[model samples]
Target: MNQVFHRFVEGIVRETDSNQEEREDLYEELLSHLECSFKDYQKQGYSNEEAMRTVMTNFGDERKIGQQLQQAMYPYRREMMLGLSVASLLYAYGVYLSQLLIMGDAHILWLVVAVLSSTALLLLTVRPVSSLNRRLWMNSLLLIHILIFFYGLLLATDVYHPVSIGLTIIASLILLLAIVLVYRTTIYDFSSNRQRSAKDAKRLHFINITTGIFVVFVILFFLWAFLFFSAEMSPAVFIIFIPLVIWIVSYASQMHLLSRQKKKWAYSIAIIQTAIIICLIGLWLLGV
Candidate 1:
């Protein structure tokens, strides 16, 4: 009610990772508890300012209390994800720089992706959105992060330095940890939202796995063509990426549709894109 109590509760809620509704609930709960303590102090003959000061002092430091509440509520999951994800990104940057040194050129696309991924991760880390939107954002970013890091690992092999080798090993481990954290985070989100059914859970798992496999296959197919056979079909090598871009666009559209629960449209998009990708792959194989 008063400024001091309001600010104290606000400080605690600021340190938490919660949706808007949960945050409001937490604020009210904490404020009510403090009010009760303040009233009890008044009943024992303390003045208003004295009661307020005593209440705050007994409650302890706002930062420490907030952190403890955050840990109690989330068990350091957010902290773990943020730390590991940033470390993984740093490892990626290190490996990419090494590739630049070894090959005398770097893929500007990877640099752009790294920048975009970092921005997205930072937004997700600091801003709290609805449950559905948060899940979608996290799912999309983590998938792209894993794929790009894997490609970076492939490029890391171009260098033979001890530092590069060690960085690669550390990066690989970080990648694994990121993947596990993403999976567990997804599960934790689903559990927190008790309205989702077992069927929805299975569908999510299927979509994630299918999407990962489809995108990985597409990337590998293009890499194989460009790396091993580009000399023979140099003209067509760049052209092949046209279909890859189209496939990627289709995938993005499918994900949007799925997020909106438009399963029929999403499946239609996937089917058409797969057919187009297959035709493009056939043309490339035939040197067309």
Candidate 2:
């Protein structure tokens, strides 16, 4: 009987990403409910196994419990996606008009906006898939973002180096194709599974912090290169790389924390990241 109770409680906990307190509360409630069911079963002269079966049956489906918990915890993601979609369309239109008014090529500006919009859409849409699909989409997006970063780098070097923009354009197109594929993949994987465990969430957060740090280092390294080795670099490099670095770092930290288990390390990483971003922005503003 004790073993039976333990198994049932473990099932509930496994099905939801409830915190320890919430799990404890649910366990107590389930125990009380099961105790009552057991007493009722004994009164009806059922055997111990039959009583346990009856108790388990009345506890209802673990999957349903998981679904309800997910809905309760993440009710805002869908709404957020909708808002971002609308905003992206509006921003794209505005950029189009600005390009027409400027009466010159605005490919780089439009591309940057497209990258931003696509990233937002991916975050809102691509998450919450089966493990296999999730990993695939994540890897594809990682490649796409890397390519976009390099595309900007190429554009910045074009004026000084005058290399063919053909390869850069081709890479950008391929990145767009990848984004489209991932977007289509997301539409089919909307059903919720069990939420990520707290520990998994924490590890993901750590990854984000590490990625953000890497971006900052990259940006600083390039800035130093441009200042000290002006003969080998162009000022345009800073313009494109700075924003790319900042955007990547910011979102990496944010989503990483969102997916992780809450912990002291999570909070500490967040504080440090915020401080770094603030300091960088301040220095940039002061033109230092």
Candidate 3:
């Protein structure tokens, strides 16, 4: 009966005129509701076959039910489509931006990698076989991106010399983009969203502060290193220092925030990172 029920839901999904995500959500909700109803029927002494029959009867005409569900999902379908369109536009613009910003004959490679990354993201969005499959796809997409980012950074450092106008523009754009992305991500905590006390709120605030500081540090350190080695100290180093300022500002802000929130544990972590940064800087200054 369970197998038959799955087949039934899959059939409904096939007949539905909604997007993949909506269809999947509809299938899961319907399956869960049927399971609950089936259990209730069993509790009332109905046999498995009898319960299955009752569930199907209560479910009404599967075709009509699917149509209704599809109709109800129209608004969500539009929103999903809109979001997809936005991503597509962003991907397209980002690729072209790279070509214009990055000097050399590497734009061809950039275009190829960008297309592949965008395609992977698109397929991951629509393909719905299993959670494991989806997770693998997501991981692969992230890996592709990380590799591409590193490759680009390498090109910027080694290939693109005389780091002047184009490099400055690229660094500024990247910094702007990084700051925005980090700000958006740090605004929300993705881990363990359970309810919490005032301390938890403080911890979350502390985490965001640390994250912002780290993000700035990473971006600036790379940019600084690149500019320092390339011997182009115009606006690149200046732009990098903006994030440096943010590092100081973020720490001071965090210190005040943690004190207010009474999350003293964050202080230890902050001190540890500060010590490491100071040590690394001292060693670097000493030509280590």
Candidate 4:
């Protein structure tokens, strides 16, 4: 029975990419189930061969077990993939819109509306509670992308500033980082042990909330400076926001989902954000 359990566990590890703790738990559960089955067979006065056959048969199909495990481990994989695809399409639209904004052919009011709408759609898709909700949000994202793309084509043929190009580059990078972090954190939480101490979890949550608020302030400051103060857009702005957004998003997701695990990635993201802020401020002070 011990040898059978060992072989069963080996098969599970080989067939799936489950983390060490999960694999062990699954192995133990299967062993317990099999032991119970063998006991039942013994009560029926079956021979050893008959008992083995009965136990194996009662265990159900191995493939079915694998499928069940996969479902349990990754119930959200499909939703995540769908969200990623929507984000990518929206990003492509943003690229188009940037080109239009550069060409000076697109109206600023329309561009603002399109960008804001697309961003809202992206956020909505990121947290839909159901498949129907996700589909609706995805459709909205796709529609916004199409609208932005056409608007961008019109702008590309018009006169616009080169500085707009730099701003677009920065915005696109931030959006890309957002998509990557979302995908990675979602997948990691699904696969990792992610059991952390309450103290650690609280600390992580605090960091996430604080950093997220800070990033929101930075974003608002930029918006205010550009729209209200009439400040010229600069590459430095991108340097500041890209890492800030990445860190905040990563920290928030980790705090919410994987609070118990050692969050090395979250800390690394924070450090990167701080470095970028310092570099941007230093450059501005030097009159560059």
Counted clashes in each candidate structure: 0, 5, 0, 2
Candidate 4 lDDT over residue span 112-146, tens digit each? 66567655655554443322333334433543443
Superposed model 1: Cα runs more than 4 Å off: 82-86, 100-141, 158-168, 189-288
The local distance difference test score of each candidate is: 0.69, 0.53, 0.54, 0.53
Clashing pairs in 3: none
Model 4 TM-score?
0.41
What RMSD value applies to candidate 3?
10.6
Where in model 2 is the C-alpha error above 4 Å? 19-21, 43-47, 73-279
**Comparing 1 and 4 on lDDT, the stronger one:** 1
Give per-residue CA lDDT, model 1, range 190-267, as digits (tens). Answer: 343423243444455555555544556567557754775555655656664564466567666766776677777877
Residue lDDT tens for model 2, 19-125? 44455666777678778889899899999889888887877776666556545644543444444444444434444444444444445564665557556555635
Which is better, 2 or 4, measured by TM-score? 4
Which residue pairs in candidate 4 collide? 103-158, 196-260
| Candidate 3 deviant stretches above 4 angstroms | 2-35, 39-50, 54-106, 133-217, 220-267, 274-288
For candidate 3, what is the TM-score? 0.41
Q: Where does candidate 2 have its weakest 10-residue lDDT segment?
A: 184-193
The lDDT-based order of candidates, best leading, equals 1, 3, 4, 2
**Could you tell which candidate, 1 or 2, scores higher by lDDT?**
1
